[model samples]
Target: MSTSYDCSQPEPRREGLAAASGAVRAGQLVVFPTDTVYGIGCDAFSSEAVRALLAAKGRGASMPASVLVGSWHTIDGLVSSVPQAARDLIEAFWPGGLSLVLPHAPSLSWELGDTRGTVMLRMPLHPVALELLREVGPMAQSSANRSGSPPATSMEQARTQLGEAVPVYLDGGPSGDPVPSTIVDLTAVEPRILREGAVTAAQITEALGHDVPVAG
Candidate 1:
């Protein structure tokens, strides 16, 4: 069954953060809020938990999940390379809504969805998200809704969609951006837009370079 924890009280004290991370550490799923939308996440290293997350979404193995971290220092350990333009983008809009796809560490396990030598990484702007990630270290996270369904913008939506499958619902209220993050694949010869959500194509081109191909 699902448990709901409120995050209106702020970080650390917010029991939702603690409970969610606790669940993640134990290889269980927690539905939590992010800058863009709610996500059902688990410890990235836990292959079992990752499998469960995909199953919960009715997602296919070909669709990889993203990892959420608390800081830039944490990112280095997860990815193989963070290009200069990618770094510039992170410095500019991270802790906000932007997903950078970088080469994965050869040593990192890939059971967490498809991750095929690549990982979509983000440092959420919300206090609740950061607090949760800090406790869990890194989470294999994705939108808290079934695959092909509209992403949940609030805790209630997450609960409604996932129900008892999620161990805890970190209620951080509505997300700042109802849409998902703009996903840029830095692993490509030219940065490719896997998905365009919050960061506009114009904003990314200006930051990365005007020549970067805009995936329609």
Candidate 2:
């Protein structure tokens, strides 16, 4: 059976974090709140867990999930190198609504999908998510809804879509308007906006002190 927690209360928040952490470590899926929307997550380094997460969402390996970190420093270990523009962006919009896609360190033994030697990373600005991430290290996460469905903006919506597939649900209330994080691809010579959401292209250009192109 699956379990759900009302994270508004102190006791439940603590308990929920614990349960969510346990589930992730066990290679099980857990639903948690993020600044943009609810996300289904599991241990990032666990290939089995990653496969399960993709399967639960009815998604394929080609469209891989992104990894969520608890802090900015976590990026250093994940990627091969951090470009100056990436550092500027991380300083300007990290822990908020920006996702950076950079080349992963060749030494790391984890697989997210057909990432093509790259990984998308973000540090969400949510207490429950940050707390759980800090406890569980990095996690492979994606919007808490099946493929081609609307993203879940509340615990109920996530549960309704994911159902028993997710073992633990952390209820952090509604996510308000679903503005996803802006995605910046740092793999190329010049940074480009793969998808604009909560953060705008102008803002990213301002952050980098240059005009960054936005892909259609």
Candidate 3:
């Protein structure tokens, strides 16, 4: 059966992270709150745990999951390079609702499912997420919900949809906006907006102080 912990409540925050860390260490799936939305995560190094997470969400193994880190430094060697523009964007809007797809490092295992040699990466702006990432290290995560369904915005929704399949749901209250992150492929020549989400083209432009040509 799955466990729930209230991260907003001081007592449960510490215990929740400990439990979530234990779940990750045991190669079990965990549902946790991110800055953009709730995410289901597993130890990035464990293929078995990755498979379980995919099965829980009814997601195809072909779809690669994004890896969330405590900060850019934590994800440094995991990705090949962060484009200058992408670096500026991260400097401005990361730890918020932006996800960047950059070339993957050859040294890392491909279990995160980045068959295209790129990894979706983000540094969530939530204390719970930061603390959890710090404790458990980088985590392979995607929105916590059934594949093709609206992403869960609350721990209760994740619990109802995922049930006992997920090992733990770190309850940090309702996620804001109920929208996913803005995904951009920084590796592309013109940079492509893979998904129109919380961050808009105009907002990204504003953040960068220039009109970024976004591929369709």
Return the top candidate by TM-score: 2
Q: What would the per-residue lDDT of candidate 2 be over residues 1-216, giving only the tens digit for each residue?
A: 899999999999999999999999999999999999999999999999999999999989999989999999999999999999999999999899999999999999997999999999999999999999999999999999999999999999999998999999999999999999999999989999999999999999999889998998
**Model 2 — TM-score against the truth?**
0.99
lDDT of 1 by residue, 44-96 (tens): 99888899999899888898788998988887888787778788888888888
1-216: candidate 3 lDDT, tens digit per residue: 778999888998889899999999999999999877789999987988888888888977698788888876876788777668787878888788888888888888758763588888889999999888988898989889999888899999888889999878899999978877888888776676788787898988887777765666
Clashing pairs in 2: none
The TM-score of candidate 1 is 0.93
lDDT of 2 at 187: 98
Best by lDDT: 2
Off by over 4 Å in 3: none
Against the reference, the lDDT scores of all candidates come to 0.84, 0.95, 0.85
Q: Rank by TM-score, descending?
A: 2, 3, 1
Better of 1 and 2 by lDDT: 2
